[model samples]
Target: MTTEPQRLQYLEAMGLTAWTARYRMPNARPTEACEWELPVPDDGARQAPGERLHALLDAPAEPSVPAPAAPAAEPRERPPAGERKARALLGGLVPEAASEEAAPGAAPEPARSVESDEPREALRFALQVACLDGRWLVVQPGQAAPSPLAQRLLANLLRAAGVTPEHPPAFEAFHWPQIEGLDVQAPLDEARQGLGAFLAGRARRGWAPERLLVFGDEATLARVLAIDDGRSTALDLPAWQGPALETLAGSAEAKRDLWPRLLDWRREWHGEAKGEAKGDA
Candidate 1:
């Protein structure tokens, strides 16, 4: 639980101002008033723009000079909406580019939506892969490190699955666009290829798992499933897709709903009459 002073500090850090009641309420504990601690500058310090503006406003005003009037200019027609938008996009840096199609009697260009104009972002994915007791767990990446409470929940889940300390899960991270800032034309294909290669490499090293525990939504799980081709020819693991780890961590009802599915998978893959332990290589 956060104390009042700590809460005030947090608010100040976020650039928020806090207001306090002038009078104390009946049956309430007496509390110190929250106040802004604005720094006071020395007399020799430079004046702020506001102070200078106030000084200038208080000073005598100078007489302004009248300029000669010029002849009125002819009114021009407004350009089409597309041309106006193009000009705004270019910031008037290239004047000729904006007016290239401004020829007399030319048809207006069709308006394009901003969404259509912008390039679509590449599909990106991050997954937490863990190998435990002859099973591969591919979970949606959560916080870099889980909180103590979240860790406890994960431990409980593992224990329920008959995992032991002697067979701690081996973890790895998989991310698309592996090299930061690298432009990937087809991220979906690349991600599938990369993931497939990783799985195949692990299999060749004789670390193949019997079952795959996938934790993601349908859309996310689909991408992982689509890698069944040349790249992962060595793998033939049975899979069980379920809700993401973060979802299970936040919802007790979701955890309860997951047990039946987990038990079914354990029976099918591990052939465990009960959720019994299996030796993992």
Candidate 2:
């Protein structure tokens, strides 16, 4: 059998805002890297101001400031309640994307949940860092439109990437608006840059994906590894002819030893009425 990595625990970050990245090792506990920085935005509503300062900066003194309009899409939704818990050392594998939407306020639905019969007996825990392209997709089940991040990191990523709306549900962020089409949520456009940096930092901390895909933009690839010194670099992943949008990582076989056990006290959080809920999914 192959030996696991000696060290784990990594974070993907950039300037002001960043997310955490966790790594698992065979026969050992999983760990993660510290957080990083990405810039903050001035205002959530001020995102995607289509005029450059150069034009307005040189324009007549009496410029017309247009009124802000409601977002050009459906309203936001409420997030489902409850997060999963886990314990245990792992066998050095990752998990697949379990994309089932939980009803609003329902019992916890797992992206992946681990429970075992022993203490600290779970094999691993999971982190759901959702993103809508460069934007951080903040969506729930019962909501309307999403709120934009009032942060610079997100804005720069959008501005730097030349973000645009492809379809109502599709917004793109990139350097060349014509070429780099990143479909993201409108509210998240502001924080795109920072999120990219966050994903990059996560990669350094052993959160790298064995299989990577790029949908919307290269940030999908960044989900696996950070954007390095090279732009025209090779994507690190297995050979799959499927769609490029879903960059997958890890294997179920490597996660054999995850200890799956709920806390003695928290088990009752669901209560016995969850018998039917437990049987589903």
Candidate 3:
């Protein structure tokens, strides 16, 4: 009984993908949903019940910030630890790399895979999720929307602390010329590359923003993040951390308050998503 517009509305409303076991209508009875198992954008078919519900949302509706700039020259490659931690530590958080087939018989492609090798749960990052200009806003400085509050606090703190902020975002992927005493695995530039790749997903099927913020409710944030990818709804940054008080860019309060909230969001959603995934399983 649902139409494409209605389906898209749900997607827009939720701001992410829905692969859980429950039907979108909550009231609607469950069906096999074989048709929806196809890829998005031109995979036209009068498919499963979920399609009618999932299609209501739009794609490319949000704007992603540019990642942090790379250093003038590639940072000297640090030695990869010959002996690292357990590989599956991230398994408990992300569960599986997003690379698993979305549906039973779908083709293997980059869009269908979401990956995290690090043990994300133990890391810390301040997730800031925001939307503006009819497009979703990312916190990537230079590329991300400028937040006066964030920039002023982080920049001042970082410069004084000798910590250089990465433009693309993420500490693991890039190199910080000025920052000292941070032992994150990747540098800012490198981390941003991974985050950038995630956003390229069909929709907002990317990482959990450490600092998830929206003008409206959680639903608003979800919609903007997933606008480009039909399958993504919300974001989660399991591994986000900040510099020490003497070595950070933002105020001690902002860093403490903002980052913890981001982690709290993950903790809450992690519980919920785990439940949902289990239900689907």
Candidate 4:
């Protein structure tokens, strides 16, 4: 049987207010707090023995307040005598400055310069191209267009190779310069993987050429080969079996050196020359 407080808690939980319907005897004093027993269900519709026991066990338990926890122990202080002795020993072991007087004929060691810890500047350059058919892809340092001088130089190179700006070549040019937002200073392996994928996609779309004329600095070539030796030379790409000519990127001098080489390559591609196309610079 529950107490008066428990009964009142249950009634409150059930959303009902409990009150006593008191009947006062004439001249009788008020009684102390009273508890009324709740009516039990009839045994005719009785619950199973196990179920009754489970209900009794599952009833809400009385809440218990926890006792206060013990305070933590304070850390021990260090002994001042030991600390002072350590300080004294360290003071006694002080390294004296080297003697100004050098041993006879003994050469002094050269002072080593301290290297800067600052990161080196990122390599920056644009790979630009001008096709025989007046199509231009002029990538600037920051992914912008090539200057007019650069475009004119490319045009002159194309003319040297017997390609007129009015007429497009039979084969589609491999457009490497049009790659947008390319980080030139990205890790070699990562850049090569991305470039390989790009090349493969272009090849799938019938953009594979017999020969690719890559005009870029040593760094660009290194990016293509995924190496850092600064050697720029012809190598076969995964997408194309033909040679990819790596030439110097900027300036009129570089273009002048490249035109004759491009002319020879164009001749070989057209079957005009008897020997193999010498695409390597």
Clashing residue pairs in candidate 1 (N, C-alpha, C atoms within 3 angstroms): none
Off by over 4 Å in 1: 1-122, 142-148, 163-165, 180-186, 204-206, 218-222, 226-236, 272-281
Per-residue lDDT tens digits for candidate 3, residues 1-281, read: 44343343334333345455544675777667564355455666655545553443222235545558843453243222212212222233223423332576876755544434442221222333332221223333222334555546544543433333234232211111222333333333323332344344323533333332222123322323443322223343322233322233445564555553443333333444646544643
User: lDDT tens string, model 2, 1-281?
Assistant: 11111011111123123335666557886567877544445654442333443343334446445558843453243222222111111222232223354456777755654533222211111112333333323111111222243223223323433333231232223221111232323312223433344456544434443322222233333332333442222333231121111121132332222112112112222332445535542
Alpha-carbon RMSD of each model: 17.9, 31.9, 28.2, 28.8
Q: Which residue window of length 10 is worst by lDDT in model 2?
A: 1-10
C-alpha local distance difference test of each model: 0.54, 0.30, 0.36, 0.42
For model 1, where is the 10-residue window of minimal lDDT? 226-235
Residue lDDT tens for model 4, 1-281: 44454344334433356778679878988888988654456755466655675564455546555556955554243222333434434465433333344466888878886843333333333333223332321222223344455455555556666545454333222223233343333334333444344444444334443434444334554455432232222224211111122223334465555555665645644557435444432
> After aligning candidate 1 to the native by TM-score, how far in Å is the CA of 265 from where it should be?
3.9
Provide TM-scores for the models. 0.43, 0.15, 0.19, 0.33
Q: How far is candidate 4 from the true structure (C-alpha RMSD, Å)?
A: 28.8
Candidate 2 error regions (>4 Å): 1-198, 204-206, 214-233, 239-281
Name the runs in model 3 displaced over 4 angstroms.
1-144, 147-149, 157-163, 166-198, 201-218, 223-281
Error of 4 at 257 (Å): 3.3
Give the best candidate by TM-score. 1
lDDT of 1 at 229: 30
